[model samples]
Target chain A: MSRVLMKGNEAMALAAIKGGCDAFFGYPITPQNEIPEYLSEHMAKEDRVFVQAESEVAAINMVYGAGGAGARVLTSSSSPGIALKQEGISYLAGSEVPCVIINVMRGGPGLGGIQPSQADYNQITRGGGNGDYHLLSYAPENLQEAVDLIKQSFDKADAYRNPVMIAVDGLLGQMMEPVDLERTPDSKQRERKEWATDGDAGRRGKANTIVSLHLDPNKLEEHNLALKEKYDRMVENEQRYERLETEDAELVFIAYGSTARIARSAVESLREEGYKVGMIRPITLWPFPENAFKKLPDTVHTLLTLEMSLGQMHQDVKIVNQGRYHLDLYARTGGVVPEPEEFIEKAKAILKKEDAA
Target chain B: MNSDTVYRPKQGLTDREFHYCPGCTHGIIHKLVGEVLTEQGLIGEAIGVASVGCSVLNYVYFDCDMQQAAHGRAPAVATGIKRVRENHAVFTYQGDGDLASIGLAEAVHAAHRGENITVIFVNNAIYGMTGGQMAPTTLIGQKTTTSPFGREKEGTGEPLRVSELLATVPGAAYLERVSVHDPKHVRKAKKALEKAFDTQMKGKGFSLVEFISTCPVNWGIQPRESLDWAVENMIPYYPLGVFKDPEKEEEDD
Candidate 1:
């Protein structure tokens, strides 16, 4: 098949379908409207189910139900819309119904702006909804990686019976990239899903129940512990990141999603000037790449976290770094996109200040 | 030499005793749903979405694949399940607080989308599970814990006529409002549920049967008196009978 140019929003929509998604339920929201619009146009042509729900709240509930019933489902929105889905996302996580959700994020804390920002990094990685739950979250820096991760997330979701979120900035969703739109579902792990609510007709005379409410405190505790165990396993196996030229670097730039791209540029320019700087880009934000903190050269004495938010992922870096190195944040918040020049200047000053002290 | 067993508990209902208060019509409504599922042979293929409130435990009583949704979100949940398994009999059981108040958008939107599913709404006029707050269906002048001085038409406005509102949606294939206070109305309710299920089986569209019910404990009255109070108060505000039926309408055209 020939590669075709596609927008990030539409690419993720097509990716889910290629990964065996049976239904799409979502509402209209900015920087990601093309996702629902594309599905609304093509789902019927493909004979796939599509519903433009009344609100993000209803859309996520539809996703929860559809996912509970053993169908591969998908939903997409931006920051404000994603906030509306928090309550239902908690339910989906609690019920352990596998589905895929995409947050092509915009500036936020509340109605911040409809522009590219990493403000939702904390919200997506930290469970924004109530309760002790963690969804496998991926932050891809480019359109290709976004499509690739989302395409693979559906099966991974089923393998664990959990929801997987793809968090990107508005820029990725709006930009166009060339990709092969080949629809192929994973044949491995095609075993029958016995846990799905596919009717009691085939099961041996017993009803299936999908619920999140554990009324008795003891039972609820048990459920919570079980979820914790699942998250622990995810941490052990799913942590992912990309490290570049950090062996002899003095300061490492830590970032993810859109900011990671800018950080990469900053590192490249610093390297040309013969300054000791490198980059570490986290692909999976939750199940965060703690392994990146395992071994470090003596020359690496500082960790610089660059983000579009006001220092969210810096917390994660500090938690893992555990004071082994001096940690700090260089961020642009509320819809401000940072240029590589500011990072080059900040990194030189922060490192020069360390030397002077 | 054995005689044919003509009558027995249908496989659609479990043996567990209901948690509903004594004299509440929830048990009656559950039985009617169970009976209809069995009669139509849809029991094995049924998936019920249990709402919050007293019926939060409805999953345990319905002998089919069941899901318990967050308060007022069962219709949306049922919509999800039905979209995935179109041939399966999917239905949602919701109370006034769960259906009319917080979940009004979910309910109305599901109907507007013409989602092929069944809804069994229990309109008891007050929130029974939360200890008698005035619900959307609570009578205009009715007294409840939240409406101690009785509801004021000038303040909270009139009680919501949920069944009538849903009937106006073109996607709704069938709509009915019935009560379980008397034997005649009980029989009528059973038929309404059966018809709603049939509408889903034929892939017609959305169908809902709202049961005007009672809550003795929350209403501050004896169980028997609550039934009389419902007949005297709720019946007139939310009248009984079908508001929309797709087959009949198509015939008229």
Candidate 2:
């Protein structure tokens, strides 16, 4: 497949089509509007479903409707918009509906700036929606990876019978990069959803009801435990990360999405200056790629975690670290994208402080 | 057991008993919908969206593909289903609290988009499922748990006329306000439901049938008295009539 230059949001949109997405329901939000805009025309041309919903809340519920009706569905929004979608997301999770949601990260506590930020690390990985549920969340650094993951996510969602989220920063959504949009099938085989409520057509013996309400306490407990088992399977089988030169290194850097690209640059410059630094890029945020920490050589003593927010991902790192390695955090919150040199300076200062201690 | 059966239960409903309170009009309304779908031979081809009010558990009773939606979100969910399954019949069962109060945007926008679906709006003038709280469709002088001092039009505003409000939306192809106070009116309400479903089947656009229902327990009245109360108090404020009919307009023209 030839690589074509495309915007990050648009590529993900086209990738959804190539991934056998039968419907798209979304509301327009900054840095992610192109996804809906592109799909509105293309989905029509492809004879698929496309609805520009009234709000993010309605869009996600529409996703619940489409997915429950046995259509491969997708929805996209930014930070505050994603916040609005939490109610429907909880419903989708409780109902065990399959769908994909893309959150183009932006600054927020409430209506914060539209600039790129990883402030939603907790919102995506943590249960933003009320429930004991987790989304199979991925954070990709570049257009190609975003397209591939977004495409595969449909099948992953269907396979797990759960929602999958792709978390990309506003910079990635607005940036242009060359991407190969060819459909690459994942090995996970998706089965036919017999639980879908797509009208009987006289074939079904009974009506299929898509629901989340369990009135009985013991029944609700059973449903929660069933969901927990599915999440545990995701943890065991779906941990993914890219290890860059961790062997025989003194320091390791942890980052993901757009910040991971900057961290890679910082690591390369530091190695040239004889700092013996490596990096670990986590592709799966929910699974947290704790296995990456186990791969670090005994020589690696300090691990630095970087983000565009105030140490949200740092919480996960600390939980997984268990004080095995000295942990340090460097964050530039409120939509500030730090430069590679800044990481270099931060890393040097951290190493100097560690050496002094 | 098979030969002399003169009257059979509606096939569109399941054997599962409804959880609605005695004399609640939800059961009567459910029977109307079931009869309409079964009579139209759409039970196999219909999908019902149950809302988060008294009708939340209608998914169990409605013998068709069903999805339970969050509070005030059944319209949005129904839109998603209809958009995906265009050839199939899709409808939402919502109460006044679900449709008028919280889900106002979802309901209005679904109509504004002219989504090919049906809405069964039940206006009982009070919230029944939440122990008789004041609803958006509550009568001006009616008292409830939330409006203990009788609903004052100054602070809470008057009751919402959902059928009239939706009639103003250009996308709505059919809008009717019907009451189920008596046997004669129950027949008319069922006819309204049939027409609403017919509008969807004909691929017209958004259609809604708003039913003036009785909540005996919530209203602090006897079951039969609640019907009379609805006729006397509710019907005067929410006058029954056809609010919009695009196809009827065409015929008149």
Displacement of residue A309 (Cα, Å) in model 2 is 0.8
Clashing pairs for predicted structure model 2, backbone only: none
lDDT (tens digit, per residue) of candidate 2 on B1-253: 2879755576689999988887788988998899899898898989999999888999999899999999999999999999988989899999999999999999999999999999999999888888999998998888899999999999899888898888889899999999887778888998898899889999999999999888999899899898889888988899998999977878988
What is candidate 1's lDDT per residue for B1-253, written digit by digit as tens?
1478644564579899888889899999999999999889899989999999989999999999998898889889999999989899999999999999999999998899899999999999999988999988888878999999899888787899988999888899999999998888888998899899999999999999999899989888999999999999888888898999988999999
TM-score for each predicted model, relative to the true structure: 0.97, 0.97
Regions of model 1 farther than 4 Å from truth = A1-3, A180-189, A201-203, B1-11
Q: Which residue pairs show backbone clashes in model 1? A: none
lDDT value for candidate 1? Answer: 0.89
Cα lDDT tens digits for candidate 1, A212-283 = 999899999999999999999999999999998898999999988888888889899999999899888899
Error of 1 at B209 (Å): 0.5
Q: Give the per-residue lDDT digits (tens) of candidate 2, residues A99-197.
A: 999999999899999999999999999879898999999999899999999879998898899999999999999999999887476324356679999
How much of the true contact map at the interface does candidate 2 reproduce, as a fraction? 0.86
